[model samples]
Target: MDEFLKWYFSHNPVAAASLGAEGYDHTLGDLTASGWQTREREQVQWLDRLSAAEAPSLDDAIDRDLVLSQLRGSIALASWPEWRRDPAVYLSTIFAAMYTPFQRRLKPEAELVESALSRLAEVPGVLAACRANLDPDLAAPLLVTRGLGQARTGRNLLTRTIPAMVEDAELRARLAEAAEPAARAFDDLVAFLEGFECGGTWRMGEKLYSTLLREREMLGYGAAELHAKGQAAWSELDARMRAVAVGVNGGDDWRAAMESLMDDHPPTLADMRAEYEAETRRAREFVRERDLVTFADGEECEVLPSAEYTRPVLAVAHYLAPPPLSASRRGIFFVPYTPDDFTPEQVRQRLRTNSRAQMPSIAVHEAYPGHHWHLSYMAGNPRTVRKVFRTPYFTEGWALYVEKLLHEQGYFDTPATELAHLDCRIFRAARIVVDTALHCEDMTVEEAETFMSTKASLSPGTAQGEVSRYCAWPTQAPSYLTGAIEIDRIRESFQGTPKEFHDRIAGSGGLPLGLAEQVALA
Candidate 1:
C-alpha cells in the first residue's frame, strides 16, 4: 500500500516536483486531453473500486497511523475537482509547490524548462475539457477555474529566474529561448482569461467548495467550524497585538526595537543578506537551545537572497531543498534579495519585511518548525504514504502552533520577540477573516489588502499581493490558523498525558490529521 501510494503521488506532477521524485519529471507530455482523460477515468474508476470494495475498516487494521490517513485521503483526492482542468482546484499545482526547480540546481534546469514548455501546449486542451466535461450552467460560488487553466499553467514558467538555477552558458542560451515561449504561453492564457473567463466564469459552486472543506477538514478542520474559529482567533490576536503596541518614540517601541535589530532596516542589499544570515544563525541557536523539532546534527542552513526574479512571489523567506537528496543535509533559507542598486527602498522593505521581529517568528512557521522540519521529518519517515501525502493544514498548523510554542516555552521572551510573536498572531488572525472575506464574503481585493496593511501593519504592496494570493487560492489562508487551532485542540485534548506528543504516535508523525487523532486523542 505504501509503495502504491508513492506511485500514485509520484505520478501527480505537483507532488513529484515538490517532493523531488525523480521518475515523474516530465509533466508536459502528460497534461494532454487524452492524457488527462485517461488519468481522470482511471481515478474515477479507482475511487469507485475503493468505495465499493472496502468498508473503510482498514483504519482499524492499518498499524501505521499515517498510512491510515493516506488511505483515507487517497479516496478524497481521487474525486478531486470533478474536472481535470479546473484551474481553481488545480492551481495549487502552480503556485504553492514547484519552486525549487526554478530557483535552485536541485535538478537539471533544462529538463525543467523542457517539461514546462511541453505543458504549455496542454493547457488549452485541459481548459477545453473543463468546458466540455463539466456542467457549464453550474454556478454558485467561486469559479470552478475553467478557461484559465492555460494561464494558470503559464504562471509557473518563470523564465526570469532561470539564470539563478543554472549558470552554464549553453543552458543559459537554451533558457533564453525557453523563457519566451513559456512566458508567451502563460501570457496568452492570461489574455484569454481577461477576454473570456473573468466575467463569465464557470463556478465549481458552493457544493464543491463544501466538498473541498470536507476533504481538507477531514485532514485539517471543517469549513464553517474553521470560519468561526478564524474569526475568534483574529479577535484574540488583535487584542494581543494592541497590548504590545507600545508607541515608538525612537528606540522605545517594540517596532523600533525590531527596526534597530534589522540594521536600521538595511539601506543596502549586502546589509540585508547580512541580516538574513544573522537571523538564520539566530534560528539555529534557538532550535539548538530548545531541541525544538529534530534538527540533524550536521544540518546547517544559510540565509541567502532570493533570486531577484522569484522574490516577489516567494514567502519573504523560503527554504531551498537540499540539492537532489544527495548533495547535502542542509537547506538554505532563501531570503528575498533585491539589488540595492536596482530598487533600494523596495529591497530594504523586502529584506526587512520577513526577518523583522514578527518575521523570524514566521521562520518558525516556514523554516524550522514549519515546512523544512516537517518535510525533512516526513520525508525520512519509514511510511511510504508519508512521503507522498501532504496535508497542508496539518503541516502548516503544526508550524503555526510552534510559533506560539516558542513563546510558551520561553523561546521568544524578549519584549521585542514577544511583540514579533504578536505581529505574527495579528497577521494570521487577519488571515482567518481575510480568507473567508475574499472567498465567501462581499469584500473586494482592495478591501482585503487594506485590512491587512492597516490592521496587520503590512505594506500596501505586500497587502495587495497577499490578497491576490488569498483570492487565487481558496480556503488556504484559514488553514494556517485552522490547523494551528486544531493542533492546539489536539494538544489540550491530551494535555496531561504521560506520553510525549512524538512518542504516542511514535514515528507516525509524517502522516496528517487523521493519524494525529488516533495517537493524540488516545
Candidate 2:
C-alpha cells in the first residue's frame, strides 16, 4: 500500500512536492497523452493489487477502503474523454505545478528560485505535449475560455508578478530570460483555442455524473434525491436568513440585510488583510478557550493575497494546505484582492464578497477549525494511506461541519454575523442544486449562473466563476453540503459533546463520511 501510494505521487511530481514529498522539488510531471496513458494503466493495476490486499485490523481495513475508493474514482475519472479534450486539465496542471511550491514557500528563497526556474524552462515542452493530447472536437467551449483566461494569467505571472517578488539579481536575470518563451507558448495556446468556432460542451451527462457520485463521492443517493436534499436545505437556510434579518433590521428582507452588511467592507486591500488576520487570531483563541477540539502541535498558517495566475478560477478566498511531507506546518489562505486594472464596480464587487460581517465565519472556515485545523490533525497521523488519498467530501465537509459546530457553541454573536454564516450555508445548498442540474439535467452554464446569483445571492461575477468551476469539476461543488450533511447525520447518532464528536471524525485522518460513521460505531 505504501509503495502504491508512493508510485501515485511519483507519477505526478508536482503533486508530490505539494504534499511535502522530497526529491521531486526540481522537476515537473510529464503532461503528454502518453504520460497520461501511462498513469491510467498504472492506476488500474494498483487498484487491482489494492483490492486484493488483506487488512487484518480495523484501522488497516479502513485504510484499505480509503485507498480502494480513491483508486477506483481516479481510474473512472481518467476513463473520461476529457483527458484528450480538455485544455484546462493540461494547462491548469502546469499552472498549479508552478503556483503550489511558490505559494507554500517550503524551501528557502534561493532553492525555491532554482526549482521554479527549472519548472519554468519546461513550460514550452509541457505546452507542446498538451497540444498533442487535445482533440478540438471534444474540447468543451467553457473549458477553452477558462484555459485562455488562465493562459493569459499564467503569462502575466511569469513575466510580471513572479519576478517582482524575487530579490536575487542572478535569479531575476534568469527569470527575465525565461519569461518570453513561456509567454509565447501561452499566446500560442490562446490563439489556437480562440479559432474554435463554437464553445466546447461542458456537460458530462447523467451516466458520468451518477458514476462520479457513486464511485468518487460514495454517495448513497442519486441526482434527483440530492437535488431534493439541496432544495430542502436551501429552503431551511433561506428561512433562517430571513428570520435573522428581521431580528437585526426590523424586516425580513435578506437581500437588504445583506446590502447593509456589505456596507462594512474594508476600503483597501491592506485593511482586508488586517481584518482577516485579526479574525483569524480571534477564532484560534476561541477554539482554545472553549476546548472545541485538540489542535496539532505547532499548527499554524499564513494569510496572503492570491497568486496572479489563480485569480481567474479562485473564489473570494481559498486555503492551500501545507505539503504533507514538508517541514513547514503552515498552510496558506489566499484572499483575492481587487486587481489594479479592475473597474470601479468590479472593485466594489470584490470588497462586498469579503465584507466585514462575513469575515468571522470565513476566518473560522479557512483557518482555526476549518482547513488549517483539519490539516494539522492529518499531519499528526503517520498513516501514509491517510496522508495520500484526500476526498473533498472529507476536507470541505469537515470545514462546513466545524462552522456549524462553532455557531452552536455561540461563536457568532451579532445578527449580521449569524446571517453571514447562514448565507454561506445557502451558497453551498445552491451549489448542490446547480452542480447536479448542470451536469445531469443539461442546465446551461448561463442558467446555472443565474441560479447562483439570484438564489445564492452571489454577485454576477462570482456566480459566473462558480458556474464555470462546476462545469469543469462535476460533483465537487456539491461535496461541501453532501459531506457536512452526512457528518451531521452521524453526529446525531453520537450521544456526546461536540468536541467528542469532532475528535472521533477528525482523529481518523479525514476519512470518507460513510467509513467514518462505520468506524465510530465499531
Candidate 3:
C-alpha cells in the first residue's frame, strides 16, 4: 500500500505537496501530454501490483479496493478529452499549487515562498503544453469561455495574492519577475482559444456519461435510472418548497418567495463573513449539545473568503478539507464574498447568493456535519489510502444526509429557514436533472442554464456558472443528492442512534455508498 501510494503522490508533485506529502514542496506537476501518458502507464503498472497483493482484514480489503478504483479513475480521466480541451484542469492546478501551501501553513513562510516561486516559474511550460494538447474541434464553447475567465483570474492570483503573502524582499522580487511570463502564458491560451469558432456544444452524450458513473464513480445505476430519480426528487422538493412559500406569503409561487427572501441579505461583506462564522460556531454547539456527531480531538474549521480564482466555480461556499497527511487539522470553509471590483449588479447577485435565510444550510453543508466535519474525522485516521481515496458520494452524500438530518432535528429557525433548506434540496434536485440532461440528454448549455435558473431559482449568471461546471465534469454534479439518497435508505433501516450511524459511516473514511452501506449494516 505504501509503495503504490508513494508512486501515486510522486507522479503529481504539486498534488503531493498540497496533500502534505513531505519533500515535494519545490516541484510543480507535469501537465504535458506525454506527462499524462506516463502517469497513466504508471497507474496501470501499480494497479497490477496492488491486485496481486493480499488483504488480511476488511479494512485492508477496502484499502486495496481504493487503490484499484483510484488507478482506474485516473486512467479513465486521462482518456477523456476534457483534460486537453478544458483549460481549467491546468490553470486551476497552477493557481491551487501556489495558494494551497500557504492556506495549509504546511511549511514556514520562507520555505513556502521558495516552493511557490518554483511552481510559478513552471507555469509557462505547463500552459504551452495545454496549448499544444487542446483539439479545437473537440473544444466546448462554454468551457472555453469559463476557461478564459479562470485564466484571467490566474494572472491576478500570481500578480496580487501570491506576492502579498511573501514578506521576503528577494522572493517577492522573484515573484514579480515571474508574474508577467505567467500572465502572458494565460493570454496566449486565451488568444489560441479565441481563434476557434466556439459554436460547439458541451454534452458528453449518454454512453460516456453512463460509463463514467458505472466505472469511475462505482455507481450501480445507469443515466436513465438516475435521471428518473432526479425527476422524482425535483417533484417532491418542489412541492415542499411551494408549501413553505404558501405559508410565508399566502402564495404558491415559491420562486417569488425565494427571490424575496434572497433580498434579505447582509448589508456588507464583513457582515456576511461574520454571519458565516457565527453559523459555524452555532453548528458546533448544536452538534455538541445534541450529540448529533463526533469529531476528533483538537479538530476545528475556519470560515474564510474563497480565493479569487476559486470564486467562480465555488460561487456560494466551498469547504477546503485539510490534506489527509497534513499536520494542520483545520479545514477552511470558503464563503465566496463579492470582490471589491464587482459591479453593482454583480454585488446584488452575490448578496442574493448569501442571503440570511439560506446561509445556515450552506454553513451546515460546508462546515459542521458536512465537509469540514467529515474531513476532520478522516484526517485523524492513520491510513494513507483512506485519506487519498475518498468517494464524492460518501463525502457529499454524508453532507447532504446531514442537511436532512438537521431538518429532522428541527434545526431550522423559521419558516424562511425551512424554505431555505428546501430550496437547497431543490438546487441539488435540479443538479440531477440538468447535470444528466446537459451531459446525457439533448440539453444545450443555454437550455440547461435557463432550466436551472427557472427551476432552481438561481440568477442567470449563477445558473450559467453552475451549468458550466457540470459541462466540464460529467456525473459528479448528481452526487450530492444521489449519495444522500443512498445514505437515507440505509439510515431508515438501521437500529442505531444518529450519532452511531454517522460515526460508523465517517469511520469508514469516505467509502462508496454501496461499500459504506454494507459496512454500516453489517
RMSD of each candidate relative to the true structure:
5.5, 1.8, 1.9
The true-versus-predicted C-alpha distance at residue 392 of model 1, in Å, is: 1.8
**Clashes in predicted model 2:** 6
The residue-by-residue lDDT of candidate 3 on 1-522, one tens digit each, is 888777877877777776777888776777788888787788888878888999998778878877677677766666565666777878878887888877777577778877777777888998888788776677677787777777767767888788877777887777877787887887787787677554555677787778767766678887988999999999998888888898767898999998999999988777888899999998878878899888777777988888888765656688888887877778899888655567889877887878988888988899988999889887877778788778887788888888888888889968889999998988999999889988776687789999999998698878877887888878888999999999999888888898998888787788877677766888
The candidates, ranked best first by lDDT, are 3, 2, 1
TM-score of each: 0.75, 0.96, 0.95
lDDT accuracy of residue 418 in candidate 1: 79
User: How far off is residue 520 in model 3, in Å?
Assistant: 1.9
Question: Cα deviation in Å at residue 281, candidate 1?
Answer: 1.8
CA lDDT of 440 in candidate 1?
57
Tens-digit per-residue lDDT, 1-522, candidate 1: 544455465457655655556655555234444655566566555444444443345443333333344444444544443343244433334433334555445556667666645554454444444334443333212343332432443444355454345666776666556556546655655564454432323222344445666653464444455567767876776666545545332333444444544443555656666765776566657865766555544555656766443444443555665532243445667766543243556655565665455556766766665566555554455444445555666766777777877788776766666777777776777887777656555467678888887666566766766775675556667667667766777777785542256334323443456666665665
How accurate locally, in lDDT, is each candidate? 0.55, 0.81, 0.81
Decoy 3 TM-score against native: 0.95
Query: For model 1, what is the error of residue 279's alpha carbon versus the real structure, in angstroms, after optimal superposition?
Result: 1.3
Residue-pair clashes per prediction, in order, are: 3, 6, 0
Stretches of candidate 2 above 4 Å error?
Answer: 197-199
User: Per-residue CA lDDT of candidate 2, range 251-367, in tens?
Assistant: 998878887788889997778888898899999999999998888777787888877777777667888887666556788887877555678888778888889998998999899
